[model samples]
Target: MEIIKINDFNNHTLSESDIIKRILSGEKELYEILLRRNNQKLYRVIRSYISNTAEIEDIMQNTYLKSYEKLYQFKHHSSYSTWLIRIGINEALARLKTKSKVLHLNTAQNLNSNSILERPDTSQLNPESKIIRKEAKQLLEKTIDSLDTKYKTVYILKEVEEMSIKDIANCLNISTANTKVRLHRAKHMLKEKLFEITTNVDIFEFGFSKCDDLTEKIMSIILKN
Candidate 1:
């Protein structure tokens, strides 16, 4: 089988509407546009909840298949990218549930309010302090992995994806207020997780730069495609 490089997808010249029209009219190649456009975002989102590389790949492929199958039902009320992300989240959660059972993991009780309140303070720190911060970040990642599916999804969408609360609400089919609350709680949970590792450290400094780099790489790849 010939592998498709997302960088080679030609969505730059065509508007999303035009691509959707083509896809609806049986232009299979146009589907590549959607795949390329959202693959990295989907991958990042899935990776937050899925540690197993094989399962992550399987869920991502399944998400695309589901998106393609449900294309006709898309009303275009929001961008197709948004719709695709919703599908990806659903697929990721479903896969996580199955994997949780197999691994005998209980993710529901991970985000406790008392735990967050007891976390350390890391709002200000020097660059030289990154070594300790890096270890703390690993602890944070593990804690985030322990959160319930709902909270994890909200955190990944809001923090990692940098999506607005309104956008997250639409994507998750939930209320804006709920999305805000979930995000707040998720941040608190992350702080608690990091606190256990280091008393005083900067958490955001570690991941945001890496995420920015990844975003730039994805954009460069898309433009090249």
Candidate 2:
């Protein structure tokens, strides 16, 4: 089998559709490109639902394997990343149920909103800004974790991930209008003026080292089968 670097295509990365075709035709190793491309996405999506880092990693691994097994079943009705998110959410929800964390759109409401703070950003920052960003990130992470899974999931996908409202709706199997409503609710719940500032600071990041580690692990298991 010829190994093709996705970026070798005249400096243009291959589309996920093109890569998926190759993988379906026996170039299985190319799936690594897909994994590396979307690891950050899958991580944040699952992280929004569950807080245990180990369990988050576990569900992510399972989500990748599950998606691979069902890859042929994917009809491209939606973007592959969107499909994977739905699968990851299902896997996360199953774990939540197993852990008895009642899965409901309106659940986890007893907590007060006054204590909540705001969001993230991804650009390089100076030392002073970095310190302030880190502190803000910790506070925002804490605040986000306090919201109900339903609210935080949309919030992260929207504010942090910057996924389109339609994409978020598709991922969550809800209406686009409902997606907007949830985001509004999440922001209101946080009640912080720093929403845009924090996104530039990298909230819910799955860094490069972790991304590579996950890629290798998922590749090893899939290639073996």
Across 1-225, the per-residue lDDT of candidate 2 in tens digits comes to: 445875653332678888888989988888888788788778888877766667878999999999999999988778999999999999998987877765454444343322223334567877656666665566677778777789999998888788999999999999999999999998998875356445656744644344556789999999999
Model 1: per-residue Cα lDDT over 102-175, one tens digit each: 97764443422212112355677665355456544555666777776678888977776777888889888999
Model 1 stretches with alpha carbons more than 4 Å out: 1-13, 96-140, 200-225
lDDT of 1: 0.72
Worst 10 residues of 2 by lDDT: 109-118
Highest lDDT against the true fold, candidate? 2
lDDT of 1 at 176: 98
What's the distance in Å from true for residue 31, model 2? 0.5
TM-score per candidate, in order?
A: 0.65, 0.71
TM-score, cand. 2 = 0.71
